[model samples]
Target: MYCEIEENWRDLDIRYLSFSNICKLNLLILDGERFPILLYDIPCALKVLHWTDCPMETLPFTDHQRYELVEIDLSHSKIVQLWDGKKVLKKLVHLNLSYCKELKEMPDLSGAPNLKTLDLDGCEELNYFHPSLAHHKSLVELNLSGCESLETLGDKLEMSSLERLDLKCCSSLRRLPEFGKCMKQLSILILKRTGIEELPTTLENLAGMSELDLTGLSWT
Candidate 1:
């Protein structure tokens, strides 16, 4: 059974909910709203937040709050830009900001040491993945597919744990990190439907690489 809060809500002014009851938020619906107001008044308890059609230009959150947040799914939101300098998400491990097409530039990721997987797929307007992302020394998987405006990767992409890289459909991507010399831990290199015509002669750089997936290439 499904319930809708906007249509059947008993109280219109409820502000806080316990972490276990987050599923109740799916029932609430607002028209063209700026993120759900479910827990706007509460602080540091909710860990996972998923917004459907929320038009948040900036996640106004800062470094002051000690949060237990882990997985954040903001896919297909109306966000335009954001860069958290303080890196408030100490527990954040997997972040999915896919298809938030308006975001222009990502912040210098010098503080997010625990982040492991970052999915920025279909974010076409996102041009630069800050080289400082290399600062996330623990990052293992990064997906930049459909980021048509992207042109480069970090100068150094060889983290000891870094493994999978998906750059499919990034049509405008021209420059790549020096693969044979810089990326030693990368294994699965996905370059589907991209503008790449050839793998760098130095493709041997990924010493442990197992599968090189170039699924769709106009030139290869």
Candidate 2:
């Protein structure tokens, strides 16, 4: 059951529940709200959540029950962080925080081992990524295109199973991290329109790479 109401929830003396519970919710799509929509233990069994342009500063839960979630799309929201710290979300596969300009940092990714796709495109305020994310053995596709403030990928970062990495249009990025020994499966590396001066010597280590894009670099 879904309803669209224009009333401001903050002005009402609402009871404990204004919406019914769906025990096995798999998909949810919330329209953009002028005011922030506060949620409690709703969508308990949710597998997918799409709340673009939501004004919430943080997500509610911070425990193991968050593991039931598989995918989340909060693009263009005012969220400053994902969670306090990384809790186990083993089933989570896709996370799209694209265009969330207010986001400053992401939680440690040690717990979300099975995450496959992470889209942080257009997150201008995100300056750094946690080192633990490089150890993600299941991540396949990572899109950091248009991240204007991202400066580096940490010195000791490593991504063992990542196949596609898009860094197009990151004008501030000047270097890549020292690739660890396990990045053998990485196949596509896109660095179009970045500020990198020269390819790192570690390029020799990516033997399995099938495509490398360096379209906007100066030859001199």
Candidate 3:
């Protein structure tokens, strides 16, 4: 039987019996269940998973292996971390962890080669990003808006396929990493409401950039 969550499964011990046939799952707004849904029976073929307003401190991964997940959204959760270690998910394209207030770190994303969009907006406690993100050659859009604690980008950003980067409202950010020559595909760069006082002259090298937002900044 397909267990679509219409009501909360209170104190459920879901540690066995794999739902091997289910491909997609969405937990809309089920409440009244205890925090940390002991998930273990999840199928390997699951492609898309969206669990909003989760109270779990961390995800329950059955094992350390690359998943077939293409999209995963854990918005408004208390999760502090996504996974335990590095993983390989070639088809994983999008990952949204917006509004995860307790989230402090990101995992190694070097294996998700085709990842296109990563949304980390409203992650107030996230102070550091995994360095592997700078080397993602197929990333298209990165939304780090409202990351109040983020202080800086990595030492280098070499995303050749990136098109848009949103860093608005990152009040703690003071400096940006040097952009590589591969930033030729960048078209939109948002830097509104940040602590960045000055930008590197290397920014002028983005010949294809059509939109650059520098609002709420005073010339120094």
How do all models score by TM-score?
Answer: 0.78, 0.86, 0.86
Q: What are the per-residue Cα lDDT tens digits for candidate 2 across 1-220?
A: 3344334556755344423256655666654763555465535667777888878888776476654779889999998987877677778899999999988887887788889999999998988688888678899999999888888888854788889999998899998877777888889999999988877788878889999999987653
lDDT of 1 by residue, 117-153 (tens): 9999989999877876754567899889899988777
Ranking by TM-score: 3, 2, 1
> lDDT, candidate 1, residue 132?
68
RMSD (CA, Å), candidate 3 to true, equals: 3.3
> What are the lDDT figures for the candidates, one per model?
0.68, 0.79, 0.79
After TM-score superposition, what is the CA distance of residue 192 in candidate 1 from its true location, in Å? 1.6
Off by over 4 Å in 3: 1-3, 8-34, 62-64
- In candidate 2, which residue pairs clash? none
> What is residue 116's positional error in candidate 2, in angstroms?
0.2
Q: List the residue pairs that clash in candidate 3.
A: none
Off by over 4 Å in 2: 1-22, 64-66
* Candidate 3, 1-220: lDDT as tens digits: 2244434444555434345445554222323233454454345656766777777777665555556778878888888988767776778899899999999988888878999999999999998789889889999999999999999888889999999999999999998888898899999999999998889877976778999999997663
